[model samples]
Target: MKLQTQVPLNKATNQIDYSSQLVVLGSCFANNIGDKLAYYKFRALQNPFGILFHPLAIENLISRAIQQKQYTEEEVFFLNERWQCYDAHSDLSSVRKEELLGSLNSGLLETKLWIAKASHVFITLGTAWTYQLKESGKEVANCHKVPQMVFKKQLLSIDRIVQGLKDMLHLIQAVNTKVKIVLTVSPVRHLKDGFVENQQSKAHLISAVHQIIKTGNATYFPSYELMMDELRDYRFYGNDLVHPNDLAVNYIWEKFKTVWISETSYKTMDEVAAIQKGLDHRPFSQESEKHKEFLKTLGNKITNLQKEYPFMKF
Candidate 1:
């Protein structure tokens, strides 16, 4: 007897293959999928501006990237000995002001180019709760550890979320009309926002995503539903009980593979998996003849795979 109900997933019409260019953006869950794609050696550019948790932050970055807008000194501020931009995650913050601006501009350029050639763009929204700068009245992507008193926290309305998503779609489509956009709500719980508030945030995101997909402008993947339904237990979460643990991520990834990955790519994925396993193998005796032979074989495998896809690096 089946113990749990599965989340119904339809096989995608435009499945991802080795030739497809992919752009993965948004929440840390996007990184989980992106990591899988990277392991299987797919052409994917993930979170060029780092992990953006909400739709408006994503929309802001995409808009600026499409316009090729450069970050200037005026947009960055010194905080805790590092220069930070309100528009990007702390991952892009730098010790030097000039370096931060350079990295921001470089990320924008990279994102612009990647979106232009992407065959599929995956966006995962994490929350509807955002913090607006008290002085500027601008919603900041990350607070960069700025004092809580300096920012006003608020929940975005469903209508505002929907409009932001639409704006993102318009901007992306303007640059790459044929690119398939896939949207998903992250399974990670924003418990810091309080349990009830977290639920409301996710509800807003889910509602807005469905509204967008109904117009046939994008596809929706029920990642959050899968976690909440099929894997309905605290064991699926990490030690913090906030993020999905590795087991949960792998489970969702297998589900994602069946629906979105092209069958033709399976053989190559297996080959890559073998190579990856070999690379991760730790020999007891490095000087042993057997280990030398194993290393040689691994090198040959890498060389052969690189011959087919020059972009892959060990």
Candidate 2:
């Protein structure tokens, strides 16, 4: 039987059945999760705008929620020239999947709007350890331009992680209370963080996220434990004994597939009607609140638009 649980922050759990208008962010695991959903012919969409490797995108997406513009792949542009998850280091690779998205929108504003329209947002927190720039003292994701040695190996404080999660929840609620969030802690060990320290880092992330997840809301997924328990065996790991091989990603993805694409939780007619009716089209999205009203107005005008602009039906 599929494992199911209900807690405070995460109220219910079991295999998620049916199709969902979902978006994924955080951690490299999201890439795998997105791929599996598509493989199963679900309504899941990878980052509409593009690659988002940082939390700032969370804030940006919420800021644009109230504006009445449709969140499409064309609107969002990436911060860097290119968007990616792993450096050739990851086990799974999908050239076709990588090309499907364009980039993030302008700042947090548009990103929030897209998220508001999404039915589900699944987040995977990859690591507790991050490199903070000495100059800005800010934690950097990717560290592409930032020198590795200039940064010191340190764990993000649990307090910060909790606060970030709380803020994100509020942001998500503001856009669409119906939009549920599933949080997960990635189990891939950090080979560079020392053997013992890597375990400590994983423990830190899992414990902090679990503190909220165990409450029984729809806010978390047991990705960390799933990996540690099911794929932690020596045979499952790669030669480095750090990262899991393609088989591991594939296995975890199958489990994620069962949860996000459940048969019963499929999108309802109302949601489809809204999208089909072109409620997401925002020809004039200036401010965040403006976009919010636009969607509402579009809902009101959906049928009228069909009658008036028959050619615009898309």
Candidate 3:
């Protein structure tokens, strides 16, 4: 089936001026847009705990918003309250507790909350391919410890993706009928998927996103197009091309700011880029021969952790 290519917001026959409370969901791409909206001074909420992975997380978050969806009356809990194990020597126990009993879902839930509050919701659909569990058949968190044999790779179809957006639209409208929707695909390549599979997979996502925008009124930002087209030159990519380098994110962000937000938003994303510069920049941290020993220790810890949580899903 044919789909209309989404023009840059500036080129659209009907331009939109939207400033509303925001939430970001879906994939890592939302991280950039969410940061921009916050920089633009829109009331924006990033996923409180961290990025979540599925519909249950989103549903649980909204349920919490409407009521106290906590496991018990205390309301002081972690990601999983059912587990009574505690660690006396761990400083991360508190964080682990919160994650166990808390309401943090996928990053997309952040987008959902933003949709409920904002006049317009911008969604960034990442890869169509998802790693889901075999036993429960649910999508696991990050595919951490999932047995490769037990886990399966799946790609959502155009119809299903469209239906999900429509459903989300209806759900958000139920809470606030005035919310508008903007959709875009993520441009980062998945080295995991062979090149051909990756392109066809992304095309499937772009098709659905494009088809939904064809009805008019709603907007579709060309984040994916800008990245794939304008930023795909070999020089734009990093050593490992799976994730966009900071330069690439900035290039795409500049194009996106002109189309969606403002020059100020562009600057804010730039700040993020600046901060990322020193993430792996520590003097003598890795240069010393100590790194080899450190890696061995780290590997052993990983091995032990895996043994303890073999069924753990990332």
Q: Which candidate is the best by lDDT?
A: 1
Could you give me the TM-score of model 1 versus the true structure? 0.99
lDDT of 3 at 281: 44
User: Residue 221, candidate 3: how far off, in angstroms?
Assistant: 0.6
For model 1, the local distance difference test gives 0.95
**Model 2 spans > 4 angstroms off:** 1-19, 47-110, 214-217, 264-314
TM-score of 3: 0.64
- What lDDT is reached at residue 248 by model 1? 98
When sorted by TM-score, best at the front, the candidate numbers are 1, 3, 2
lDDT of 1 by residue, 98-204 (tens): 99999999999999999999999999999999999889899999988889999999999999999999999999999999999999999999999999999999999
Q: After superposition, how far is residue 260 of candidate 2 from its true place, in Å?
A: 4.0
By the lDDT metric, which is better: model 1 or model 2?
1
Error of 3 at 183 (Å): 0.7
Name model 1 segments beyond 4 Å from true.
none
| Structural similarity to truth (TM-score) of each candidate | 0.99, 0.61, 0.64
lDDT score, residue 89, model 2? 17
Count of residue pairs whose backbone atoms collide, per candidate: 0, 39, 23
